[model samples]
Structures are given as structure tokens and as C-alpha cells.
Target chain A: MIHVDGLTKYYHDLCAVDQISFAIQKGEILGLLGPNGAGKTTILRILAGFLQPTAGTIRVKDYSIDAHFLEIKKLLGYLPESAPLYHDMLVYDYLDYVANIREIDKRQKLPRIRRLADLCGINSVMHQPIGELSKGYKQRVGLAHAMMNDPEILVLDEPTSGLDPNQIVEIREIIKKIGQEKTVILSTHILSEAEATCDRIVIINRGKIVADDRTANLKQTLSDKSRIDLTLQNADFASLQQKLGTINGVDRLTPIEETDHHLRVSISCQGGVDPRAAIYRQIKSTDWILLEFHQETQTLENIFRELTKES
Target chain B: MRQVLPIFRKEFRAYFVTPIAYIVISIFLLVTGWFFFTTFFLFNQANLRNFFGLLPIIFSFVIPAITMRLIAEELNVGTYETLLTLPVTFLDVVLGKFLACWGFIAAMLIPTAAYAFTVAMLGQIDWGPVAGGYIGALLLGAAFSAVGLLASALTRNQIIAFIIGVAICFSLTLIDKMLFFLPRYLLGIFAYLGADFHFENIAKGVIDSRDVLYFVSVSFIGLYGAHLALQAKK
Candidate 1:
């Protein structure tokens, strides 16, 4: 439902968002994962029509952002990072004001608000001053504000930042629920949150999209090198390296650590092959006692670290 | 116009939600009341000319205080993004906020009618000039509040907005006073542009379209400047 093309945003001499393009299908939950200063927020802001792009165009449902901004904005609901709120107003009053501004019908405002409050788990704190509420409740109120119009596209920037683990889980679950009916785009530095919440993950770094695919696919494609860790007793470093070096799938072997009684080594295997059985046969032929031999699969966290960490 | 109503409602009620509207209105009444009463006894006049006369100066400060937080606070709290990203036009937001602040000033002026009533009871009072003076005060407040809104839109700092609002309003009001230092050719222009130049006729119960147009033009320029500032941010 949203197509961004060559979007570039510059703040004076500094480029906040480089020329980047991506499309989000309707009812898809897309997570923008990036480290700090990765231009994730900048991209989200442009998509929400808050900031004009220095170059290129954003189109929602075939309407361009510059020409049909009001129409596009009507369909977009944005919750900025940190959930900036009016501290003086009560939660109910704030959401009501947002709903009014969103131009919801007067007859439906109360019902819509109640429904959103229940969905966001903020029904009990409706009458409390937003300033008096905890951070989690405040964020829930912000979510209700963003969803006031029942927008077709919801753009949230760091919706779970600064919340506790339980609050994070609650918000993730709420976003997951909302994602069932709406096109949701959220940005976060937390990889687990993105994996848990988003169907497709767009990993951004230095204002560029380095990886964009289905969450599972990204993990599968980026993690190509499998590792086998071995701990052995009464085995010399040279013998262990010489024996494991000639194995068919072992690409690289390096001793991790060694002591008088024990030695630890890791085998970098190629082509997703498990060389544990071959190594086990080799260790059985010798008198050296094998303490541990385990094969490790690549994790999503490893893929994230490999792609985003600075070379 | 319909979209502006929500912003107006929110902003207008926002004042009362905090102690700001009450405090500002109370201070305004107390200060203006003191000036009106003391000038009444000193000048021994049955007219409200002195009370109306001090408004240009009184409102130069008061209106800024009311309007300084309108846009600046929204920017500081990051609600500006949410508001602008909505379906409303920039004009709607500006007009709604301008009207709300102006409406508060109008509401605050409602109590000052008692000054006129007291003067009428104490002595012979002409209602025409009193009515005209109140109209002039409203227009003056509108003009100052517009300038204040423009300043508020220019910055995210409320104090800076207040200072800029006061500086612009004060300078415009006193522009005519610089006529002695200006060349003779610029005298008429300066006089015409002075914030209170058109207000004198209105205060004296002489309502000219020229004076009305002058206040409207100044207010239009201020509101338009505010609108442009909003666009520049994007």
C-alpha cells in the first residue's frame, strides 16, 4: 500500500536519510531495524508525511505524498518516538481530542476510544492525568492516539523503547494484534522485538537498506557459516588441528583456549555440513578423552550482528 | 472551517485545563482595574478613555503571554508532528489557535464592562466611546496575538517566543514615535504602519473602514507569516 522511491533527506550538510527505496504491502508488519543514527526515524517520518524528502517521492495507494498529502495523511497514523504527549491532559481527554482532530464522527468517538483503550490495555487509566501515569501507560495512550482514526497505515517509531520487558511484550502483542488488520511499520534497535512482531524485517544502517526480506529468510540467507565447538582432554593443539584440518567439510580450525588438562577448539564448517560425526570417529580412534563436541546453527542475532556491525 | 473547530476547541479549553488562563485573566483584570480606577480618580473623567488608552501597552505584554505557548509548546512536546500530519490545513491550525487566544482575550474583556457601568452611575457617561474603545481593544488584542502566534511558530522555546512577540508588537506600536528621526518622506508611511495609529480613530468612536482595514491587514500579515513558518519547517 506504500511505495517510497529514492527517498533522500538532508539536514544542512548532514544526510539524515540517504536515497533509499522500499515498498510495504497492505496488512504487512514491517520492522525497520537499525542502530542509533541509522536514519530509521527519518525514514518513518518521511513515510508519515511529517518531513518532506529532499529527493524522490512517496506514494500511498497510488497518490503521491506531495500532491495528495492530506489524503495520504488521512490514511496514516503516526506515533513518534518517546511518545510525546500532553502531560497536563487526562488520558481520555487526550484521546478524545485526537479523535476529534482526526474528524471521527461525534456519535462514534466514544465507542472508538473505548475500543482502542481496551485494545491498548489502557482502559483503567482513561481518566488519570497522562503525566501521572507510568511510562507504559503513557505509551499505550500514545498508541490509542495514533489509532484514533482507525487509519489504514500505522507508522510507529520506537514504540517499545524505554518500556520494561513485560511492557515490551504487551506492546508487541498489541502491535501483532493490530497488524492483523492494518499495514504497520515500526522501527526498533531490538532484533528480538522485530523478529517477534514483524513479518518482514528491513535492516537499515547508515541510512541505507542492507537487508530486506522475510524475517526467517533474512536469517537463513545471511547465516551461511556453521560452527562446531570442541573441548577435549589429553589432546595436543597440533594433533587436534592436524586431524580436524583434513576433514572433508572443515574449512577452518582454530584453537580457542588451552590449559594443562583441557583444550578448546572451534571448527568453521562449510556448506552447512555437520562434521561432528567425523570428528567423533577421529577422537574414538585415539586415547584422548573427548569432553564435548557440539554443532551450532546460525541464529538471527548472529545474522543481525554480521550485517549491522561495522567492518 | 469545520476542521478548525476541533483545534479551536482543544486550544481554548487547553488554557483552562491549566492555571494559565485563570492566572492571566486575573492578573489582566487586576492590573487593568488598578490603572482604570487610579486614572478615574486622578483625571476625574466619566469616560473610559484612559482605561482604553492603556490597552495598547497592556496588551503588548498580555497577548504575547497568551499566544507564546500556542505553537512553541506543541513543537517542544512534539505534538506539532501529529497535528500537522492530520488532515487539517496549516490555515486551519493557525486560525484555530489565533481565534482561541483572541477569544480568551475577548472573554477577559467582558468583565471590564463593569468599569463603564460604575462610571455611568457615578456621573454622566457616554456609552458610544466606551463601546468603541472596547472594539478597539479587541482589535488591538487580535493584532498583538497574531504577532505572538507568528513568533511562537518561529521557535520551540516559549520564552523566546514571548520575547520575540513582545519585541515585534512593541516596535510596531512605537514605530510612529520614530518619525522625528526619519526623513520627511517616510513620515506618512511610519504613521500608517504604527500599531496604534488606526486605533485612535476607533477609540474616539470614529470607525473608519481605513482603520478597520489597517488592523485587519496587520493581523492578516501576522497570521500569514505564521502559516509560512509552519511550511518552512517541512
Candidate 2:
């Protein structure tokens, strides 16, 4: 369990993280979604005991970050952005060193390292120097380093940044597997990563929390802001708008583009009701050909853009 | 304290694993060997006095080179963040790294024992001053390494850390030679401050507690300064 209150961090004149407060329950995978410079990494760093906040406090399992950070540190396994590990050391040596520092039992150290190597998929490159490995391999080594102690909480800052798409998926799968038991807090600018992996999402912008809710519930709550896109073969805009205007939930119909053979239009709708059925019934009585008609619920990507719009 | 050993072992092994340790040791042996043996026949002395004499100035540069990358490289590569987030404390890091650098200085000194051996083979050698000289060398190495670690912790740039470390260690070694230029009344304080002055006293086979305390205190001040510098970043 983690509790953060008024966690503020300032880099001299500029504020990195404002008075942000959030709590995470045990075994919850909380995704911190934010654009660049949105204080997502700052919040995670403060929680990991890497940086001291300018103001406010963080507590884990009743132990305060200010006074009991060493204990909290023992509870956390942190992977910094891009996984900056010792470049000169061999991967096996690096993990062995981490295991030793974490005070893993002398006898259990090798077996534990083997298990983590298996979990992170880094056994093949175990003998290679970390600098010689690619970004994906370096990140896996960083993961093994973080999980060496098997800490209860894992804080990853942009774990998938600079990786290939396949690497991203692999890292996400690893994170999802870890999320089954441990408390995992990860920050990412990628919207879909949050949607696919996190149980709950906290959307932050300009050092402020804009939205915080369950991933499913967030999209469900904004489902009322839906749109029905239509591609009509023969209907003209004036008559089609006139005919669809009578539907109760449909707010407005706007023409998108007109081709020689088809007329494309987007109908804006409000309320939680599905206006697709009524619109289809209205079209069923008419002679217009329905080439394409699909209602798209507001996705997390759209909601993210709405909350943290471009400046 | 318990966590210090792992960090120390890692840092120590890291030096040997990378080419830095070999390069530093080779250069140290070359410079000391060339300078010490070149004057060997001219002085015809059985003692390692010339070798120990060159150490205060030589170590001023050598120890910094040994220690410059200790903290600066970690900061530059961003591994300091990873290391700090572990369960270790600041003291754990500083002590571990300080001991590793000191241990490196000891290891680097091992090859120079051949110089002492060659001297004993050539002529009658007084083992007392030779023993004292080696002891003084270790103490001086520790003090300089501590100062270098402080400089390394002060900046994320290894070159700047090396330069700052060399500056402080060189000043400590050179201060005694400039004592005549100072006002008569402040002479004692400046003389006492010169690192070379205490190191020479110990190298004379006189293990005075004051001289021993001087190196120990200098090392303490340097390590403590490094600890404060790291804390100030937070």
C-alpha cells in the first residue's frame, strides 16, 4: 500500500511535480499517464526514494518516506528510464552484485538470479557486458536488477521507451505478469500501454492530476460522447440531416466529405443511449443505401487528448 | 556497514575488469620506476627514500586518476540513481567506494615493492625506514583517494573531478615548500597543513601519533566532505 499527499517537487524556478496526491492499494497496477514534462517521472522518482520532494510526504505500509526510506527502499524495486546500468560489468556479474547488495542469501543468490534471468528473458546474454547489449537487452538486465530482491513494490519509469514495438509488447507482458501479486507503478506517455496493462489509470498534465479512475470505468463514463459515422451512397446532406434530426439522442449531423459516388457524414450523439438502433430504423424506411454505419465509443486515446490537449 | 562490503567488492572488481586499473597501474609503475631507478646509481643509497619522496607529489596525480571515476562516472552514466534507490545508505556508498579506492592504491603499491627488493639486493638496506615509508605511502594514498572521491562526488564530469582532485592534492603537497614566502607568525599553521611535511615525518621511521593522526584526519575530512556533497544534491 502507498499513500502520497501534496507531493510537490521543484527544480529551482520550475516546478516539476505540483501538489499531487494519490493512493495505491496492494497488488494494484497503477499507470501514470502523462505527456512529456507532466511530472509523471518526478512522482515515480519521489515514490522510489530517488528524489526528495520539495514538499509533502509519501508513506508505504505505514512507514514514512522521510524517516523510514531505507525500509521503503527495501520494499521497492526501481528501474529508471532507459535502464542506466553499469555499462562495464557483465550482465551476470551485475545481477550477482545486486543480489549480494539486496542481501539475498549466499546459497539462494545464484538460484534467484537464475529465476529472475528466466523471468526477464536475459539468460542468453548473461555473460555479455551491459554496454554491448542492445537497448532491449539492457532494459531486461535492468529489470532483473530491480527484481533481484523480489521487492513488494516495483516502480518503473518509462520502461518501454526507446524500445522496438515487439520489445514494448514483451516488456508489457512482463509487467502484466508481475502485476498479478506485487504493487506496480509505471509511467508512460503511451496511452494504449496504460489501457492494456493497468487496472487503474491516473491521467496527469502540467503537474496536475486531471483524471483518475478505473481504466474500464473511464471509457464507460465518457461513453456518452460517442459518434456515429455514416457513408451513404445516394442520400444528400439536406434530406439526410432532415430525416436523422428526429432521433432523440442524436445531437447534430455534419457532412465529412463528398465523393462522386458516396456522401460521407458524421453524426454527433449525446446521452448514454445507443442512437444507432433509432438511426438505423429511420434509414430502414428510406431509399438511401447504407454503405457504412458504425457508432464509435470515446476511446481512452481521445479522452487523453481531451484532458491533456496540445498547447 | 554490512552493505558496504558488496559495494566495495563490486567497485574494486570493476576497476580491474575495466582497462582503467591496468592503465593506471602501468603508468604509475612506469613513472615511479623511471624516476626512482634513474637516480638509483647517482645516490647509491640502499634506502627507498627517493621513491617515497616522489610519492607525495606522484600520488597527488595518481590517486586522483584512480578515484576520479568512482563517483563521477556513476553520476554521468546515471547508475547513481539505480544504486541510491537500493537499500544502501549514503555512508554505505561513500565508505564502500573509499575503501575500494584505498584498496586499489594498496594494490598499485604492490609492484613498487620490487624497487625495494632490488635495492636490498644491491646494497645494505634499512628495513625500518622502508617499512615506515610503505606505511606512510598507504596513508598518503588513502588521504589523496578520499580527497579525489570528494572531488568526484562534487561533479558529474570525470575530467573536472580529476582536475579538482589533482588541484587539492597538489596544493597539499606543495604548501610546505612555499612556507618561506609567508609571514613569520603564520608559519607553524601552514607547515602543519602541508601533507608532505607529515608524510616525510612518518617516512623517517618515526611513527609519531601526530603524523598518523594527520593522515587519518585528512582522510576523515575528505570522506566526510564527500558524504555532505552527495547529501546536498538531495
Candidate 3:
């Protein structure tokens, strides 16, 4: 578990992370979502013991970052955005080095390195120079290095940045699997990825935490106005639109497309009502074949844009 | 101490894998060997007097060239973040890198022993002076390397590290010669603090504790400055 209080990091006159406080529970997958220059990486760096906050306190597993840095570092693993790898070292060699530096016992180092390499799916690249590998392989190697010592906390900065779509999904699954047992704080700008992978989301903007809540709760809170799309055959377009507009919950109805036999309409509802039943009753009296009706819920992408834009 | 050893081992291995250690040793042997063949053989000196006397001047440039990339390259490539975030302390990282460079200098010196062997084979070489000269050269190389490491820590640019290292080493080595241009009252005191003053004393077949202490102090100061620089960043 990690606790950060009043964490403000200033580089001279510029504040990178400003007075942000958040606590992460053990075994929680916390997604730090923000656009570029949104202080996500800065917050992660301060928590990882790489940067000293100008005015704040960070505690990792009850060890103060200021007083017990070595112990705190022993409990946390940080993977920077760039993967900070030695180009000339082989994958195994680099992990071995990380294991040794993390103070894993000499006897356990090899076994741990092998286990992590297997877990991160980097076994085939173990003997190859890291610089020679592709971006996906390199990111996996970085993840392996972070997991080499099996630290209790993992702080990853944009772990899926440079990978292809398939690689991103694989890496996200790996991170989720790892998060099941360890505390994970992952920083990313991709809203969908965070929604798919994290247990809770913390949206940051301009060096401040704008929103923090469970993914489902956040979607529910913002899904007040739902839109329903309907397609019909042999429907009177103007009559259907006018009739649907008169329903109690239906706020607006607009024709999306019209053909000789088929008409597509989008209906907006007010006050979180299900307008499909009312629309169905109104169209029952008309000579129209109702083909499709589906409600559109609010997505994490829309909520992210709305929240970040408010800042 | 446990963390220091792994860092030391990795840094030592890095020098070998990156061709830095090899190039340094090869250049040192080639240049020193050339100097010996040309200066001593042509002049026909029975002792390795010229060879040992010239080592400090050679080390002034060679040691810095070897140590310029020790920490600066890590900063340049952003690996310093990885290094600092580990459980290792600042002292562990500094000592590990310092010892690695010292090890490389030692390895480079090993081949130069052949020159000592050649001189011993050719004449009645005084083992005392030869031993003294080796010690002096090793200390001088270490001091130069430490200063270079400090300069490297001040910047993330390896080229800038190399240039500053060379400049510092040149100034330290040539400071004694600059005494003639200084005010007469301060000339002796300034010369006594310069590297050449102390190195010459050690190379004269004598183990002066004061001269030994001088090299140790200089090395300590340089490494201490490097430690402070890294600590400031953290």
C-alpha cells in the first residue's frame, strides 16, 4: 500500500505535482489517467523514490520515503516511461543485475530472474542484447526487470505506450494479473485501457486530482441522459418522430437516415428514463416494422474528456 | 556493502563489453611502449628511469579518458534513474563505480609490467625504485580517475565530461609549472599542492607518507564531490 499526502514537487518556479494526496489500498489496480503534462509521471516518480517532493510525505508499507528510502525501495518496483535499459546487456543479464541491486539473495537471484522472465513472456529474448529487440520485447524486458525481485508495489509509467494494439492488450492483461496480488499504480492517457484494466480510476489534470472513483461508479454517475437508436421498415418518418417527441420521457427525437422502406431515428431521453417502451407503444398503432432499438450508455472516454476539459 | 559489490561487478563488466576497457588498455600500451622504445632504447638507459618518470604525465590524460563515461553516460541515457531508484545507497553506487574504474586502471597497468620486465632483464634494475614507481602510477591514476568521475557527474554529456576531465587533469598536472608566473611569496605553497609535486616525490624510489596521503586525499575529495552531486539530485 502507498500513502501520499500533500505531495508537491516544484522545479524552481514550475510546479510539476501540486499538493496532491491519494492513498492506494493493497491489491488495488489504480489507474492514473491524464493527458500529457498532466503530472501523472511526476506523481509516480515521487512515489517511486526517484524524485524528492518539494513539500509532501510519502509512505510505502508504513516506511516513510524520507526516513527509510532503502526499505521503501525494497518494497516498490518502478518502471519508467522510457524503460531505462542498458543497450549492451542481454535480457537475462539485465534482470540479474536488477535482482542483485534490489538485494535479492545471491542464491535466489537466478531462480527469480528465470521466473520473472517466464511471467513477462521474455524467455525467448533472454540471451539477445536488449537493444536489438523490438519495442514490444523491450517493454516486456522492462516489466521483467521490475518484477525481478517480486516487490510488493509496482508503479508503472505508461507501461503500454509504444506497443502495438495486440501487445497492449497482452501487457494490460499481464498487469491486471499482477495487480491481483500486488498494489499497482499505472499511469496512462488511454482511457479505454484504464477502464478495461484498473479497479479504480484517478483522473488528474494540471497537477491536481480532478476525479477519483470506481470505474463502474464513474460511468453510472455520468450516464444520466441515455440515447436510444432505432431502425424501422415501412415507418412514417415525420409521424414517428413527432409521436416519439410527445412521450413523457422522450426529450428529443431526430431522424438519422431515411430510405423508401427503412428509417433510422435517434431518441434522447431525460431524467434517466427508459424511452424504448413508450416509443414501442406509440409505434404499435402505426404500420411500421420495428427492427432494432439499442440504448447508448456513457463511456469512460466521454467522462474523461468532460472532466479533464473542466480543468 | 552487499549492494556495492553487484554494482561494482556490473560496472566492471560494462567496461569490457563496451570496448572502453579494451581501447584504453590498447592505447595505453601502444603509446607507453612507443615512448619506451623510442626514448629509452635510443638513448640506451640501463634503468627504467625515463619510463617511470613519464607515467604520471601519461596518466593525466589516459585516466580521465577512461573514466569520463563512468557516470556521465548513465545520466545521458537516463539509466541513472534506474540506478538511483534501486535499494542501493548513494555511497554504494559511488564506491562501486570508483572501484570499477580503479580495476580497469589496474588491468591496464598489468601489461605495462612487461616494460618493467624488459628493463629488469636488460640491466641490474633496482626493484625498490620500480616498485615505488608502480605505486606512484597507480595512485596517480586513481586520483585522476576520481577527478574525472566528479567532472562526469556534473553533466549528462559524455563529450563534455571528457573535455572537462581532460581540462581538470591538465590543470592539476601543470599547476606546479605555473608557479613561475605567480607572485614570489605564494610559489612554493602552490607547487606543494599540485599533483606533479607529490607524484615526483613518490616516483623517486621513496614511499613518503605525505605524498601517499596527498593522492588519497585528492581521490577522496573528488569522490566525495561526486557523491554530493548525486545526492543533490535525489
Stretches of candidate 3 off by over 4 Å are A227-270, A276-296
Mind giving the per-residue lDDT tens digits that candidate 3 earns over B1-20?
Answer: 68889888999999899887
Among residues 3 or more apart in sequence or in different chains, the pairs in candidate 1 whose N, CA or C atoms overlap within 3 Å are none
Tens-digit per-residue lDDT, B126-204, candidate 1? 9898889988888888898899999999999999999999999988888887789999998998999987777777999
**Tens digits of per-residue lDDT for model 1, A188-250:** 999889989999999898888988999978777645678889999998899888888988889
Which segments of model 1 are wrong by more than 4 Å? Answer: A222-224, A231-238, A255-264, A283-295
Q: By lDDT, who's the top model here?
A: 2
Quality of candidate 2's docking, in CAPRI categories?
A: high
DockQ per model, Cα? 0.70, 0.80, 0.68
Cand. 2 TM to true fold: 0.94
lDDT of 1 at A15: 91
Q: Which ranges in model 2 have alpha carbons more than 4 Å from their true place?
A: A230-246, A253-266, A277-294
Every candidate's fraction of true contacts kept comes to 0.73, 0.87, 0.77
Error of 2 at B54 (Å): 0.7
DockQ of 1: 0.70
Model 3 Cα displacement at B54 (Å)?
2.6
Which candidate leads in DockQ? 2
